[model samples]
Target: MSREAAAPGLGHNGGPPLEDPDPDAGYRAYVWRRAHRKAWKTPPPEIALRRLARAEELGMSYKAYTLEILERGRYL
Candidate 1:
């Protein structure tokens, strides 16, 4: 089935919550998802390649290091 054909929250736990939209942030998010998907598609950047290299030297994969930095909110 197509992604759009699927429910937004189907298979998420029992299913989508039966609640009404917030009417404020909900519509904003809908528009943002459609208009800005490409803008947010890629990873932030590789300006931190030097840091990534260090992580690699220390036996960490780039993916792991990137996630760690982002999780720590230190995207340096």
Candidate 2:
């Protein structure tokens, strides 16, 4: 687990934190989801869509639409 993950749970005094799913399992599915999932750092889908629509209103092509967003996103 990472430090950011620990701080939220660390506020617990002594007895126990909120609760762990299991001693060994430890929120297995939840952890897996966090590990595998990715999120945008810059413009999100809604923002991108708005930009695309505005660009199209200006008559940008499909290639140009994609090109404009290419630099704005990290490769998946």
Candidate 3:
């Protein structure tokens, strides 16, 4: 059935009923995702130059090094 057709909170639950529009929860999630995206995106030119230098010192291309850090959270 379509999502609109499905019952809200129909699954088995032991806790109290959930809030339909939990504004606080939604806002917290939005802020968390926004910060995560900002952290992953390329930085300003000066910072980027530093990253490039570090990547060169690591003997890897800048793109490869950046993707590695973003994915593995550390150098190999």
lDDT of prediction 2: 0.60
Model 2 backbone overlap count: 0
Q: What TM-score would candidate 3 get against the native?
A: 0.44
**Candidate 1 Cα misplacement greater than 4 A, ranges:** 1-18, 24-46
The TM-score ranking, best first, is 3, 1, 2
TM-score of each: 0.38, 0.26, 0.44
| Alpha carbon lDDT of each predicted model | 0.68, 0.60, 0.80
How accurate locally is residue 43 in candidate 3, as Cα lDDT from 0 to 100?
88
Model 1, 1-76: lDDT tens digits are 9987665665577655789767699788888788566433455457456766778787888767766765686744
Question: Per-residue lDDT of 1-76 in model 3, one digit per residue for the tens?
Answer: 8986654566646565565766699889999899788877878999789879999998999888878877888755
Which pairs in model 1 have colliding backbones?
A: none
lDDT of each residue in 1-76, candidate 2, tens digit only: 8887766455566566466657657588778667445332346779777766777786986446555556566321
lDDT of 2 at 1: 89
Worst 10 residues of 2 by lDDT: 34-43
Model 1, position 17, has a per-residue lDDT of 70
Native RMSD of candidate 2 (Å): 12.0
